[model samples]
Target: MSLAALLDLRGEPALVVGGGAVALRRARTLLGAGLRVTVVAPDLHPDFAALPVRAERRPYLPADLNGQRVVVAATDSEAVNDAVTAGARAAGALVNHAGDATRGTLRFPAAVERGGVQVAVSTGRELPMLAQALRERIAALLPEPGTVDAWAARREEAVRLPGAAREGALDALRADIRSAFGLSAGGAV
Candidate 1:
């Protein structure tokens, strides 16, 4: 499934089954979203030593999957990734495998961030390269950072309105924001 389709990682426990660049990148994203993260590997990239999360230096064990809400297997070895995926699934955790998307329950998306707005793109596991290419194109078409901040402020104001009024006002504000960005009304900003 698409990354956006999955549950939010905020306040959840996520496990990364590697400590290389790929795993580090994945862990960074999860941590950015407020997930509690644990990195398991024999060695970690030097950059990880400065992060505020837990890092366990060791081989992967099935017990590491316990109490995790989401798991990302980003080891260089496909076998290790697959093993982690299996263990994660058995523990009822959603998993994303960096080596092979089809081997896991979820796939990461190429995302663009603007203030409080985040637009993500994915083609399931069918064409990640294509999705990434599209993401770059979309990024180029986005508005300046200030515009996104203004939109977020408007959204917050809209949220204070009553039910139907909130929805209607938010929709209009969203349309105006998209228009200012030269994006289609229904397109993600």
Candidate 2:
């Protein structure tokens, strides 16, 4: 079974071996996570230029996998994707095949961020569309970004409450969160 966990990618070097829409999407997500991303492709779509990533206009080289913590293969060519997977494994880096999960060991989940809370949904690569649908459903149940500061403030005060009142304070915080998000008391996202 594939285990689910959140990784800290800030400041880590990552390589993306494509310049198409799939590669662009993966690169954007990685860049958003603060990773130092370098994308290698013979030709790039115009949209890629807008992102803050190091773009190398060249064919992917196996050596490009070196020193990378993560590598994403989004090339259209199966041979090129295979080469990237092998190179990433040999270099001890995690590999993601954007076209198909069976080609690599890593896959990204659909993510939703709201009010300082982030939720990710994975269907084990069985159905990406379902994961995205689930993410959308969960996003609607989360508090808005503007409410995050208030939630944090409540948490801070609750953490300092006396032991006897701690649980009640925490429960009240949860109730507030539920009310703000239009979720039922038993709802979970």
Listed per model in order, the count of residue pairs whose N, CA or C atoms clash below 3 Å is 0, 0
CA RMSD of each candidate after superposition: 3.9, 2.2
Runs off by more than 4 Å, candidate 1: 1-6, 146-175, 181-189
Strongest candidate by lDDT: 2
Error of 1 at 114 (Å): 0.4
Give me the displacement of residue 158 in model 2, in angstroms. Answer: 1.9
In model 2, residue pairs whose N, Cα or C atoms come closer than 3 Å (at least 3 residues apart or on different chains), thus clashing, are: none
**Per-prediction TM-score:** 0.78, 0.89
* Candidate 2: tens digits of C-alpha lDDT, residues 1-189: 787888997999999999999999999999988999999999998999899999999999888998999999999998999999988988889899877788787889999997788999998857989999999999998766778888788889989989969778888888887877667887542
State, as a TM-score between 0 and 1, how close model 2 is to the true structure.
0.89
lDDT of 1 at 64: 91
